[model samples]
Target: MRRKEDVVRGVAAGIAMAATAPYLTLKLLWLTGSHVGARDPKALDSLWTVNLLTFGMDATALALALSFVRPWGRRAPAGLVAFPMWVATGLLGTILVAVPTDALASLVLGPEHRTPDQPHLDDTIADWVFTLVYGGFGVQGLSLMTAFVLYARRRWAGLLRSRIGDLPDSPTRNVQRAFACVAALVALAVAGVRAYWAAGGEVGLPIHWVEQRTRSIATMDAAMAAMAVAATVATLVLVFRIGPGRRLRGPLTVAWLGAGSLFGWGGYQLVAFGTETTVKDLPSATPGLMNLVQAGQFTAGVLVLAVGAMALTERAVQREQPSSRAALSGTEPPRDLAAR
Candidate 1:
């Protein structure tokens, strides 16, 4: 069984790494002024920074895919391996869910025509670019997520099996509750805004943004909103111990992916187009309220992550107590609590 699992992990990691090549190559081409799939080469000039950032992100994904199968990855510090994987899962996972839904919606609704002023996805990018890049991202998300799950199960088997009610109450429960509440409110706000936009309510959007709305854009908005809600629900449940008998792994997985999506995509947009970027000609709000909302989403994600980390750390310390006592008394700790 172990050997079979290892083979599966290796194959998945290989596919993930293979899927990055097209995206990485395209980003590199753009960065080097080779407009391989760009409609207007100069249109990409202002997006050099965005391209570089995405390139680095994909490169990191490539490295992570390798780490998923390599023995050294097992020995790496937990945080070092987990953090990047979480972010990768967020970015790619959102794409994985959105792209197919978008395609189906497009098929049902038909394609919307856009004016020259509106920034449609195909405005600056070629048709083939979306196909190649998104297809790669989809494959990468599926394979990388699979590999990570297998890796995590091997390394943290006991934690995965533990129930939420089994965890000892943290001394900082009040603090956790406070942060969780704040994070939940922010997530709901973020979800509300995105959901409104997805449903074609355009109160806060610039004219160009409203005009540029397509099935794909709407699908992405809906996905982000769903992720925000999921994160909120999962985090609140875990923090408040709402489901006493629930396995810790389920909520943790949802919280991880949801919070990661909030942080990863929110941060990407905030950095990529939050400032004076020519990527999209968005309308001007009186005080950049939309930007603040984006920042708030990112902040909420951070709060969720911090609160979850604190809870897990407290649990880990408490779990270690029995083992430490056992060592001192020259007796073995329960096998169920044994380190993976």
Candidate 2:
């Protein structure tokens, strides 16, 4: 069974690596000054930084995929492995869920696509670019997640199998609860704003973004809002032990993806918005408001991560206490008895 699982992980890692090719190739082409899909070559000139960032992201994803199957990954520090996977999960998980949902809605709802009569920045790119990039991202999300799940299970099977009620109260539990509440509140606020925008309320949006709002964009907003709420609820339940008997894995998984999306996309946009100029044709938001929103979103994600990490660390220490005591007393049990 273990060998079979390894084989499955190897295959998933390979697919994940293969999926990055088109996106990485596109970014590399753009960086090297090949206007393969650009409607205006000038539009490509200013996007070197963006292209470079995305190239690095895909490159990292490729490396991560390799790690799942490589021997070195098993020896890697937990923080090193988990942190990047968290970010990648957030980034790719959104693409995984949102793109397909948006596509389905478009198909069922007859596109409902609206464009400004005036030319926009995105109009400068060929449609195929969106298809290729987003399609590759969707594939990457699915396969990479598969690989990560298998890898995580092998490494942290006991923790993953634990229940919320199994977590012993610690001195830091209250503090984690307090921070989690704040993160939850922030997540809800972010969700409310995104939900508002998804519903076509344009109070804080830049005129350009309002004009450029399309079904897909709205769907993406709706998805983010949903993720925010889901992440909030999951984290709350986990920290508060709302469902005492419930397995830790379910809520943990939801919180992981939800928080990851919030941080990943929030940080991505924070950078983009921070560097943006009020250049015409590009969809943007009110700079100050957007900066605050993304920053808050990012902070909330970090808080969730901290709370979860603390809880896990506490649980791990508790799990080891018995064995550690037994070792000191020279009364350690046999392997099977120790596991019990």
Candidate 3:
């Protein structure tokens, strides 16, 4: 019998693991007082904390990449592996598409975006080091996603079979519908903010607003908002199966990515705030109007995350029910007999 799982994807995961090493190493060096990439000698805050936070993120990616290639990952609890990977996919998926496009745009348009003034790398070999780090992130994203897909396809074909619009009777349906509706509204509000920001309308400004006026920041903010809105709406549509034809693939993908970005980034930021890593980025005194925006985004992200999780769980349970019935009646599934 052929051994299950592609050996090739395993190798690809190894490559991804290796790709993350340089970034992790550089961060380690920085944490220990090496400042090879430092641009400002007197940067407003110590970068050690940020470096550690980034290192942990990359480390998680490394572990995830390894899981795809190894037998151990298959043996582990499926949801445990799946959730972080899903979150990573959402966050990294956006960057995987955006960064290269941004690079290309900068080349053609001659660097129209405003670069952050502080915490920059020197524009030389040091900068290339930072590039390697970010480049590793993109590579980790693409490689891990490819590996996960191959792994999922081979391992659980049945659970993957449902169409997007299929609605089943669930005890949580009422709760999910209410949550999704509220979440969708919040996401729309965020999308509006992003649009306004993209168009250069500043409703609530901190002093930092002046620095964010560059084409790059506006474009990025707009893109994030638009994408989040798409995902949010798509998720709500999928959850409610709203007035639909087969809108599964596109909407499902959008919802997955959008939920991941919002949850992963927002959750990370919230947690990182308690740590030294994010304190440098946190606003002082008043929580500000942006906090409201963030709160909405976070809520939407979380609710949609619940929607996706429940959907996947239901699919898995559906697959197992037939087997459970046969076993309880002292018979085996047809495939189980064939295997023996």
Candidate 4:
């Protein structure tokens, strides 16, 4: 077969990259007080900090997008490709799916119930600013995920041939199932908090930041918890071989991505929360709420991470079949070669 290049996919990735430009530009504009997309002057205290973190995320997405068409991406270290992709899938997956629902709820329930608003969390950006930023994130996530699928399929087509139910029986499988069960339970609890918060209920462990930025934290908590729930459920279903047998690749993919994203998002939040912020110094007389969320999230992350590691390891060490053995027979196939 003649080696080919995916020009169409490359174009798609390029378009996604272009969409991010305006969002990043607007974020930079906030620092200069251009207020291009704002109804009010920026009020978020950690403007630079938030922008800096988001800038890195966009840059990583851009790099992943470029890798879809470039030679280096195919050759990039697996960890390099995996880490960012996992994060993108985890964070953006829920947001992309929920944005419209959230907007609808916000419209119907009224602005007061949209999310628990903090003292000044969103005073910095206008509604349009978020539309652009989140829109860009959604696009970038979809594009990167597409690119990765193509890249991974081209690179390791044989590895994916096996389905979830076909996973070999081993101690690792049992361990993974245990992890999944615990993760599912934790995710369920977290999801309750999220659902409550999203519904405009005050249920989180009261902290100064939660009180100040109730809506923002609530939104995040709700979203993260929900995503974790989906991931853990998918993982457990696959682990137990409940519905789909070895034939179902779709649930397997969901389990993999959901679990990975759950861990990635959990780890991201744990680190972000652990880090000292400007809010730490503010004076507050309210007795701090017993915040188990941070610890719970971290624990859930560790379990999910363990589960993912076990699954990936199992996939890696599975016995190779004839087709895969032949494909790996010392000849480098063309970069764009499709699996037989």
Candidate 5:
């Protein structure tokens, strides 16, 4: 029964993660447009809607994931803490940085015409606020990643001697470990990009030194996206191959699916971002791609939520099934023995 519950929780978490895709894509589009200043008003409005929806989905998913945490477990508090911290950073970015910056740019340049090359109002303040917000986001991302990694490790370790048995220290494990390492490296690279941007360093370091540092961040973004996809695939494969119990099968499958969706969305963003810049040249391809990305991100987020719900439902069902079976058999055992 406990095994079943674990499966459910794992699936739920995966679904919740998937639900973020559409919103993420939309945000990416808006960001791409903001860089090129070619996005239509309608697209901008749509992006905002997607953003809000994504946030709501994220909150729900986080709540669902939190419910699975055991009271005495180390991961419980970490998961709980990480969710709010992530929310805080997101709010800080949207309210203090993104919103204000957009408003100031619109007010100063007049909404009819704005471009990245043009100077706008509140640039310095926006930059500073964005830097701080990004830093906060980085912290939250790192913390959550660490917590998940620890949780995964502990859970797998605990199952080592079970029926499914310990995984051999083989090439596959090595590959999975390598994927994990790459994911960590990607995260660190993103952090480094953010830090450089915050410090007003030039982007495109060795490629196009003349471009602002933000341009370099784009490459890092692409790398991160790729790594995210790889990590998702690797984790899913690992879980599916090594996870124990028929009861856990469903939840783990859901988790695997949800993770795959997230990976797809992330990969899409990378391609979209590159396409918008290289092929479409900002504002032109940005709106459409952004909308697509946002929708994908949102859909992913919903899927993640659904996964979480399914996991929770599975757990509840498993918990009840035993009692139901016992009742059906008219097996009201001795209280002490039954409790054990």
Candidate 6:
């Protein structure tokens, strides 16, 4: 059973790592390009490639998440609420709002339209798509961050109040807390920026015109990138702390893979932001970076899903073993049955 679990975790981790490579490479290419034209044939090709990669990653995440249901004793009430909210926000904001806006803007405005310029038919549609999709993603991210923070806080409080003496803080606990905080902050910042844009107002009051507008957005992007890097590093450190042992190997391995996914995804977010922001003639780099970040995030999401799956599987196996279940549950069999 232990060996089987390890195999399952290893395969999942390998798939996640493989998914990140192309996505990351494309992002780096765009970032370093002397001139990256969004409408350029090459840029479009890169975009399609990233889309394909992310599709695969998302599929994997869904599969892994499904696998966890049996053992986790069905989805927890909290997860039930949180997961749907995250998915809905992601779909609505990205597909419904952001994508259409960006596509219309590109088609009608010939890829050069600025806000308030009464974009061409195609440009207008594109703008609407971009607004909703990106906005949705940002909202979804905020929701997940909030959920994770609450979960971590609960765990921390339980640990502190428990009778388990000499329980030193694990690296996993510390990293998880750090990630929760960073995720929450990123979500807040993104939300604030979106709100500012929605109100037909830009940040950096009065000096909003000229280079300041671009600079202010760039600064926010940079800050997000830095936090992502920190989170990735912290997650990796936690991964290395998984000790070697037969019985403990499966869960540890799954957790490690999940951490790796987080690291890759977080790192990619930073790179994608840098590439998009620094590109010349780019409308803010958000569009170009979308697919890349999605790929990384999906990959990380899969690993986390795998962790849940392993936990569920363990629970299922335990239930099947009546002796183990009886011991843990403290339920004794009838004396007559025992005698028989």
Clashes of each: 0, 0, 0, 7, 26, 34
Off by over 4 Å in 6: 1-42, 57-126, 145-217, 224-262, 266-340
Task: Give one digit per residue, the lDDT tens place, for model 6 in 26-87.
Answer: 44444455223243445445455454544454443343333332334123454553343333
* lDDT by residue (tens digit), candidate 2, 5-117: 99999999999999999999989999998999898889787788888888998899999999999989877887888888999999898877788888898788885644457
Mind giving the per-residue lDDT tens digits that candidate 5 earns over 1-340? 6566566556644553444444344445554554323224554553554445545544543453453354444435533543343333222222323334445656776654436685332342244534443443344333333344334444433222223222233334444445444443443344344344445554433222223234223334343333334334444444345444334434333333333334334343444343433433432333343344434433433333343334334433444566777788998633322211
lDDT string, candidate 1, 73-156, tens digits: 988888888889988888888888899998887788887766767677587789999899888899999999999898888888
Could you give candidate 4's per-residue lDDT for residues 266-326 as a string of tens digits? 5665555444434544443222222355455556766876776676666555543433665
* Residue 289 lDDT, candidate 6, scale 0-100: 32
User: What TM-score against the true fold does each predicted structure earn?
Assistant: 0.94, 0.92, 0.83, 0.76, 0.36, 0.31
- Please give the ranking of all candidate structures by lDDT, highest first, separated by commas: 1, 2, 3, 4, 5, 6
Q: Give the TM-score of candidate 6.
A: 0.31
Better of 2 and 6 by TM-score: 2
List ranges where model 5 is wrong by over 4 Å.
1-124, 140-216, 227-287, 300-312, 327-340
- Top candidate (lDDT): 1
Q: What local distance difference test score does each model get?
A: 0.86, 0.85, 0.69, 0.64, 0.40, 0.39
Supply the TM-score for candidate 4.
0.76
Best by TM-score: 1
The count of backbone overlaps in candidate 3 is 0
- Displacement of the residue 190 alpha carbon in candidate 4, Å: 1.4
Q: In candidate 3, where is summed lDDT lowest over 10 consecutive residues? A: 277-286
Please provide, for model 3 over 24-116, each residue's C-alpha lDDT reduced to its tens digit, 9 standing for 90 to 100.
888887777776666553441354566687778788888988887777887778777878887888778767756776777788888653345
Give lDDT for model 3: 0.69
After TM-score superposition, the amount by which residue 251's alpha carbon in candidate 6 deviates from its true location, in angstroms, is 21
